[model samples]
Target: MKYYPQLTKRQAVSALEEFLAERAPALERFRQALRADGRDPDTLLDGTTQGLVPLWGWVLSGLTGPDAPACTDPATVPHEDWPSWERFTAETEAILSYESVQLLDGFISYLVRVVEDRTPTAQWQIGQHPNKRYQFRNHPVLAGADRQIFFPGPVASSAREVVRGRRAPANDEMAGYAQAVIEALSAEETRHEPPEPLVEVEDLGDHPIRGREIEVSLREDIAHEYSRQVDHMVKTLAMEDGITRVIREDREVLLVATPSWNTTQLQEWVTQALRDAGNDHS
Candidate 1:
């Protein structure tokens, strides 16, 4: 391979601006869909991590340059000629899913080693679903028949928790942590490795759905909420998966390593108190 002259930082920046310009209309369409759905812009659950917007802004501006529409007015761009919203959304989800898997793979490998004596090993293959969900499955660290770890939430939440030693907030507290993670990652010179290019799978004529179909199901309300989450899971997959893995691994590590009888005794009493409360309520 012949070496080409490296572009200066300024030239690279100029090229990025042009790219964002072309995607301006697509971004506007996304913003409109969010507004039409009455979604809160501040909701971290939506995959809008702290520095994500700024980063996207940088991306758009860098790619599209001055030719791109003003960032303030997503409405200025018309949606008539825009791509199908569903397709755009699916692609966005695919991008999220693809990135999440790689991050989870590296982060979990390091974390599990930190908490356990065994060396990390290859356990899962990363892949994307048609719905654009990502997974790192078939890992021994997960302790299952398949030993898989699935990340089904937003990348920001997962990244923040892993890099910052925190978990996603249930309410309003520590809301900025997600943003902090994005900013921190954005400031870093090295970018996370991009996922391998997506591959197309062909449907075979003999293929059939083979899983056992269960007659029983959850109540209507429960099912509806579950469906809603499934519909929106591209946003929350990473964080949810990471938090779960950390808690389980942390508990196991603590049990094995914490040798203080006094501390264990106090924890046992606390556990008994909580169990007693549960029994009394029942």
Candidate 2:
């Protein structure tokens, strides 16, 4: 048995739709912006950009609308709250400015991570354990048994003859036949010509590199830097507030307060301390 993150395809799709629904107002604003710019309403809605339209359509098709029949499956998402595709498209387009693409990319990347986390990498099967095994005898010939005693009677005439033979050759005559076989194999090998090398292609400008490449692990580095910043902020708070230690678990930051200092008081103190530090930095 192997441990894996648990997520279903339906669950993933529903989550994405919910995300879009929550951002519906922002999407409406995007549509307004596009209309103000004198662009066609369907410019970004027709599923042209980055193949998002198909994904949107799939999500739309799967949703259970209010007028639609009730679904017993927990994974079947309700579309009562989801914005129409027209609004979603405008919102998606509005969010696609040069720098804003990173946000959309991040959302898609996170969804992929969620799916991968739920998938199993290893499989389970029933079989004998590797430590438990039984011994078996090897073939007599393979085990180096004497050829004369173990040989299956004499070879039949049809089996022994490569070229038509009047009868099976005697053991003493086999040497001449073996020599002839070797000569025939050598001649066949000599007749095969080696393949020629591929010709080099000309350097045409058909495929051009569009943008300058920078070497950096963007996602990993950003995550690491964010963690470092958060850790430093917590450490600063601990020093200023006379806290002993700070613990981090996933997205949570914890500080154990003394009996006299309640969690609410501690939270306020930390919040104020962060604000004061920000002011000082400014």
Candidate 3:
């Protein structure tokens, strides 16, 4: 891990400029990794934007690991309380594929270090805004009986043909059809459309890039209006565009599945993640 010295408030403007100058390569890499193509982190601190969160804090947080004081016990016990930086990064692969739990824990731990050291949180931030590129895994095309059939996108005809087959009741009939539909939609295609953000992040000052974990847990009472709500939302977004999930009920069980989503338990979490990300910064 690269060590980044913290910038003090008392530092001269030249010092600040020099500080950024020294870190340009590292920060620019972060910008690419974050897809933060809009503004330089804190380079516009002069007046381009006021109280705009400096992105440096996020960078430090990314490089640092969880501090031991963050644990329930005050006494640190090496790996038990805190893992080494090498150990931390080795398992995490933070930039590419760190899981959500690792991110949350690491972030909170970094906060613990900041608070323990009496460091100002604002120093960590530089000027920058997020520009996330949402790439959903699969496109959805809803084909329901007695409902307005939605067949959109390049592979729409193929998926439509699969749905047109008899809704025969055999063992795993729904599962079979779901797989067929998935296969049909899996046809290779390219699109440049970006999904609209459901939750807006406006002038995130001294907070976070992801203001909150945008996740949706299906209401336990989905049998009520929630299922209808889900169906409606899915149908509305199922037209010829960059759709990545198709909603189909088991005719037998609409919102019933164990250990996974959909009747065949085929739908992946990306569908819900994409929806939640677009829905809110919540």
Per-model TM-score, in order, reads: 0.18, 0.19, 0.14
Which candidate, 1 or 2, would have the higher lDDT against the true structure? 2
> Can you write out model 3's per-residue Cα lDDT over 1-282, one digit (the tens) per residue?
211112111122233343234333433343454445465533522221111123322322233222323322212223323222212223322221122122223322322222223322213211111233211111111212211111112122222233334222122322233344433334333443344322221121122432211122232333243445556654554442433334333211222112222221123332354355353222
lDDT head-to-head 1 vs 3, winner: 3
Q: Provide the lDDT at 195 for model 1.
A: 38
Q: List the residue pairs that clash in candidate 2.
A: 5-118
Deviation (Å) of 243 in candidate 3? 71
Candidate number achieving the greatest lDDT relative to the actual structure: 2
Superposed model 1: Cα runs more than 4 Å off: 1-11, 19-26, 35-177, 182-282
Badly placed stretches (over 4 Å) of model 2 are 1-50, 65-71, 75-254, 262-282
Candidate 3 RMSD computed on C-alpha atoms after optimal superposition onto the true structure: 25.2
Q: Candidate 3 at 158: error in angstroms?
A: 45
TM accuracy, model 2? 0.19
Task: Report the lDDT tens digits of candidate 2 across residue range 1-282.
Answer: 100111122222343354334344444554454465564545544422233333323222232322334423211223232232212222222211221222222223222222223322311111111122311111011111111010111111112231133443233332233233223323323233333211111111122332211111112232243555546666674564445444443332233323234444554554455445452221
Evaluated at residue 203, the lDDT of candidate 2 is 14
Off by over 4 Å in 3: 1-24, 32-36, 40-282
lDDT of model 3 at position 205: 18
